[model samples]
Target: MRELLTALLSQDPTIEVVGSATDPYQARQMIKQLLPDVITLDIEMPRMDGLSFLEKIMTLRPMPVVMVSSLTQQGAEATLNALELGAVDFFPKPKLDMKRGIEKRADELIHKIKTAAQAKVKTLEREQDTPLALNPLSNIKFSTTEKIIAIGASTGGVEALRVVIKNLPANSPAVLVTQHMPEKFTKTFAERLNKISAVSISEAKHGERVLPGHVYIAPGGKHLKLHRSGANYLCQLTDEEAVSGHKPSVDVLFRSTSEAAGKNAIGVILTGMGKDGAAGMLELREVGAKTFGQDEASCVVYGMPKAAYDIGAVEHQVSLNKITEAMLNACGAAKDRHIRV
Candidate 1:
């Protein structure tokens, strides 16, 4: 697997694989000597595991690290944990015909590596206490007739969304999310969010009703849109060609929501790379939908939100910790309940 990755990365003109080691001792020696800018690590190893090593690296010599792991249940959980422990990003190691899968996903692999190289790695600290069950409110009111939330993220979105979604109250607006992720990882990512968040979360399905307190994530390789059906909105999934270099693009979702939900929608462009959602966010803003962007101080990449902010697409640029409350306020939720940033 390491050799395959090395060969793939070596083909990219902008990337060079500095060194490879089969064990932790050799890896430590190479890190001290070569002092590479980025590291691609596998979760499973013969000696010290990737998670343990990642914790050590963050504490001692914090730098950008992308995890390469299998697309299994255990792998998903461990990768999520690794993100909490300061890993920049992750890509699933394909299980089927290795050469064919690697070749097929070569562009995505190279893109992630480049994004990871530019990513800012922060020392993360996780709360060890058990999560308390949240009560779903029965009397929350929306300023508009219908309330909908659209979110788009990439790069550091795995951990960023975890913070934003987990902080939301149970009876918030119906959410539509576009996260640049692979097909196999979207389900796992949604499932992980469901376990941690107060509201239910799942991969979006065609014609599914958009209900309050539920979050829908766009499936990989497909575009997810919002369409009004009578008084309620419904999810519409399509196999449209990639927009802004991604299939389930933030631009597509924001534009669809802007057209379908109008001012009733809230468009949020979170931490990510590139300008996928910037133009769409401007459309949403023009149509009177409140829009927010993740502030630069809290962003992992700051590229996407900065682009949107530059075009006046974002109305309020808030920290990741304050975005949930800001969304609630936009939806007419009480202001006194705001969580500190």
Candidate 2:
């Protein structure tokens, strides 16, 4: 596996193939000696598990680290944990035919590596095991069910969305999220977030009514769009061709929210690589929906938000920690009081 990754990475002249390690201990030594710009850590390792090692790295010496994970349920969970521990990004390991699968996704791996190098990596502090509570937003009453929140993210979105969703009050408006992830990973992602969040969160099913106090994550292989079923909002899933180079495209969701909810919607573009949600966010903003973008300092990769901000799509540019508060405030669910997380 190391040989294959090295060979594959070596093919790209822009990326140098640094020293590879067979285990975490070796990798630690190599990291101190070589001090590479980016390191890709396999989830499964011999001496120590990737998550533990990743935690150590993030706490001790923060740097860009991309996790190479398997496609299994366990792998999905571990990858999400690694992200929470402050790893820059993750890519699933090729399941059946290793060589063929890796070769097929060669371009994607290269892109992730390049992006990881430029990512904003922060030192990770130990997180609380309990669910977070935001008192300022919790006390505000949301009278209407018409209000909706649409969010789009990729790259570092796992951790970004986790922070945003966990901080939301239980009575917050319905949230529709489009995060770039594989088919197998999205279920685990939603389930993990559901466990820690105040609001109910799950992968969106076709034709399901979008409800207040719930978060609907776009299923990985399908695009989640907003539709009006009479007075109620419904989640509409389509297996349409990839837009902006992604399935469950953020543009599709934001545009649909623009058409359906218009002024009643709040659009948030989070940390990611690429311009998927920029145009759709523009559409939402033009239609009077409030739009927010994660600022560059808070992003792991500022590509998507930067693109949106550049095109005048984002109305509010804030840090990641403040996004949930901003969204709730825009929805008229936050009081003047502030509670620091």
Best by lDDT: 2
Error of 1 at 48 (Å): 1.7
Report every candidate's CA lDDT. 0.87, 0.91
lDDT of 2 by residue, 98-159 (tens): 88899889999999999999898888987774435544556667656678999999989998
Best by TM-score: 2
| Per-residue alpha-carbon lDDT of candidate 1 for residues 29-141, written as tens digits (9 for 90 to 100) | 99999998888888888789999998888888888898998878788788877887878788787788878888888888888888888888876565542363432333355
TM per candidate comes to 0.91, 0.95
C-alpha RMSD in Å of predicted model 2 compared with the true structure: 3.7
Stretches > 4 Å off in candidate 2 = 129-134, 334-341
